[model samples]
Target chain A: MLKKVHCVRLDGDKAELEDEIAEEVPLVIFVNGKHFSTAMISPQMREEFVTGHLFTEGIIDGPVDIESLKVESNTAKVLTRHSTTFLESRKVILSGCGSTSSFLDKKKLPKICSNLMLDRTMVLNAMKAVLRSDNFKRSGGFHSCGLFNESGAIIVVDDIGRHNALDKVIGFGLIRNLDLKDTFIATTGRISSDVALKCARANIPVIASKGAVTTLAVEIAENSGLTTAGFVRGNKMNIYSGGRIN
Target chain B: MLKKVHCVRLDGDKAELEDEIAEEVPLVIFVNGKHFSTAMISPQMREEFVTGHLFTEGIIDGPVDIESLKVESNTAKVLTRHSTTFLESRKVILSGCGSTSSFLDKKKLPKICSNLMLDRTMVLNAMKAVLRSDNFKRSGGFHSCGLFNESGAIIVVDDIGRHNALDKVIGFGLIRNLDLKDTFIATTGRISSDVALKCARANIPVIASKGAVTTLAVEIAENSGLTTAGFVRGNKMNIYSGGRIN
Candidate 1:
């Protein structure tokens, strides 16, 4: 994306109307040359998006299943050849229901094993960091989510949507070859079932948000043994489940 | 909507988060009980939503086709069977693109009309008022869109997603039995083609936003003869097409 913006309609000093021409990048994900999805995203890291998308969608059980990957035009083309071992695992083809109602029947919730004791201060600070540095704050056109570890330090990535933000971070971790086990994710948006399911896909343990959590989201977190937190403002929050700082 | 929320994670002595739970309201459009699409909307304004929906979709060529109208909630239904004189028309089904893209193939631009003029003061002022009162401002939740008259004064509603807000206003207008012709819609969200299409469905002549407008949206607005505006702020905005200020 270009850093400079020009106004098309100027009523005063402010841009009442502006002409903004952006350079578009392509993210092509090819499942064995059979294209899966094409995403137009920031070109900072292409492989992260591809790996994150594949892993989140359960296309590959482990990173090794991905035979080859390519990133172009900010587009990440993930190439995985047909193999019985990969196919027999039964990946549920989910209609992308990012943070909304899903088209498919709800899958069995993810069961968590590693309960993460959240560092509340780290979360609060991370949230402030997110707000202060948000691209949306400048442009008012983007959404983001963040991931953390037990220490509550900000890790992972941010994107245009809460789902995309989380996906980018997961993808980043995959490209850099990071661990998925016992990770925590924090969002600047609501904790709906769609988000919860995304966390489950990553095998994340603790999920926190600067916004509200829905009833079904809480239920999913509980059933999955995932620690859910919402409204994590400075020095305060509501834990929707077994996630409590010990 | 409920006011005076108390959340443990809220800013100290500051505004709380705004949350509006969605409910299914039966919007029965009885074109001779032929059963138009079952619209899920707020129950408060059954009639207005129906009329606005029908008009925007270009279903009725002026409101006189209907012989009578009635609205109901759970058991409430709208008996809107049109007389045979107007029976020559069938409701146009405008469906959004499939879920994966969730974006319209916007390159297919609509025909542009050059006759629409809006009050600049009204457009900017309406945007200010709606943004000033957003749930995002108070509870830091929800997105908002406002419908404006050719005069530019905001008439109906605002919401969480760009789509939901427009729907609420449509639902509100439909229930109140308002005139939707020669209207403009303003939003704080990105103006995608789907967003443009939604406004087009209502036959809204102009669509404005404080955020970005996609390429497809520009095409749709041009072809549909809808004026498109973007990057609306204090005193300035970008007029994409079909929008002229007198």
Candidate 2:
């Protein structure tokens, strides 16, 4: 995947730099030999995306349920097989593009838990620390997603796609066997349905994005009991739903 | 939708000025009483996004088969109670996060006529012209997409969302009854499958963007008879496929 990266940064007209590296990656997914989708993502997280996308999309539930997940780095093929009726109903197919967006099942948003409390100082302090973890400051492109426990320290995953970043966190959580309850998914990208859905899929209760939030995302959070906050910079933030700041 | 907008222009750590105005005009889609997707886009040409999304995604054939295409200001929604099969298999969705990305059906790309003649230089020049069309210089955040004929002038759309911008151009083209063939779509974002599908959806043979192209997008264009190019900034570009430079 690094071999396919064509780095051509222009200074005036000519290429300031044109090099091949494993940077921008294209992953094509096949489900049951059917072309599921092709995504341009960081090659590092193919399996994570597979398990995360399949699980979060409600395609399948857990790693054990996934029959197998394979990635061919050169061809960029991510083959995923499932062992459940998760792909049942054959109801909706949406071509969701971006680091984070609302994909589907808006009605399934998690019920907001009532006992959680967010300390403004903790959240703000985390922002300053999160900025240091940005891979974008090094690569010039990429979105970062973080997961924090009740104490709000940055558990970071930086990737070219914000969704990938979230998946990395989810995967990390899975690996560490951390509980998702009362946790929050924080990202540098906009809080859309896709982002909210992933949090709901993980059963995380609160989401905070340093960017904007779509109307549908707000509606999904409001209706489903998931707490959402956007433009969450400094001491002030817009509470789109779930009533903490409100 | 305007109520969902929060504006802030910062020289540093301050909200300096804030107001809800119709600044980021682009495209958004709704399906069956739910907000499906929205992209920051040019307001003028939205119907095409509404139509092109359907076509490239294999949703519908022509505009007449659809029920209604409507746009008020920056919001565009195309609705159809089509053959139920198309609706049911439509769970996987693509919503561009105001950023051009690759998240589409690569294995099922549109087949072009194969006899189409694409003039590369003309499209590249149009790409340069597109840079000046952005209101992003004012808003500081937005992407633009345009469709141009052989003459090199284009109908351009700018938005915070690259998908919306492209959709606006498509929408505008449909309303004007414009023929997409011998024309090209130029964008200030990446040349990804979703964006490439915009041209393929319009049956346009060429697409040029002032950014990178995903490997899958290049593959789709090469096979779809759609010529693709990327990184067009002031007299330079790399031809990804399907056109003669002369």
lDDT of 2 by residue, B1-246 (tens): 233343333223435244332232324455444454455433444566677666545556667667876765545556676752333224334432222243334455666663556455676668777887636443323576778877776677666566667666765666566776756788877665556666776788877777666655665677677777666777676666675343
lDDT of model 2, residue A30: 57
* Candidate 2: tens digits of C-alpha lDDT, residues A157-190: 6665667778777866754567777577777766
The docking category that best describes candidate 1 is: incorrect
DockQ agreement of candidate 2 with the native complex: 0.12
TM-score of each: 0.65, 0.65
Q: CA lDDT, every prediction? A: 0.56, 0.59
* Residue range with the least summed lDDT across 10 consecutive positions in model 2 chain A: A86-95
Task: Chain A only: list TM-scores of all candidates.
Answer: 0.77, 0.75
Q: Residues B151-188, candidate 1, lDDT per residue (tens digit)?
A: 55545454334555676676555555665555667777
Residue A207, model 2: Cα distance from true site in angstroms:
3.0
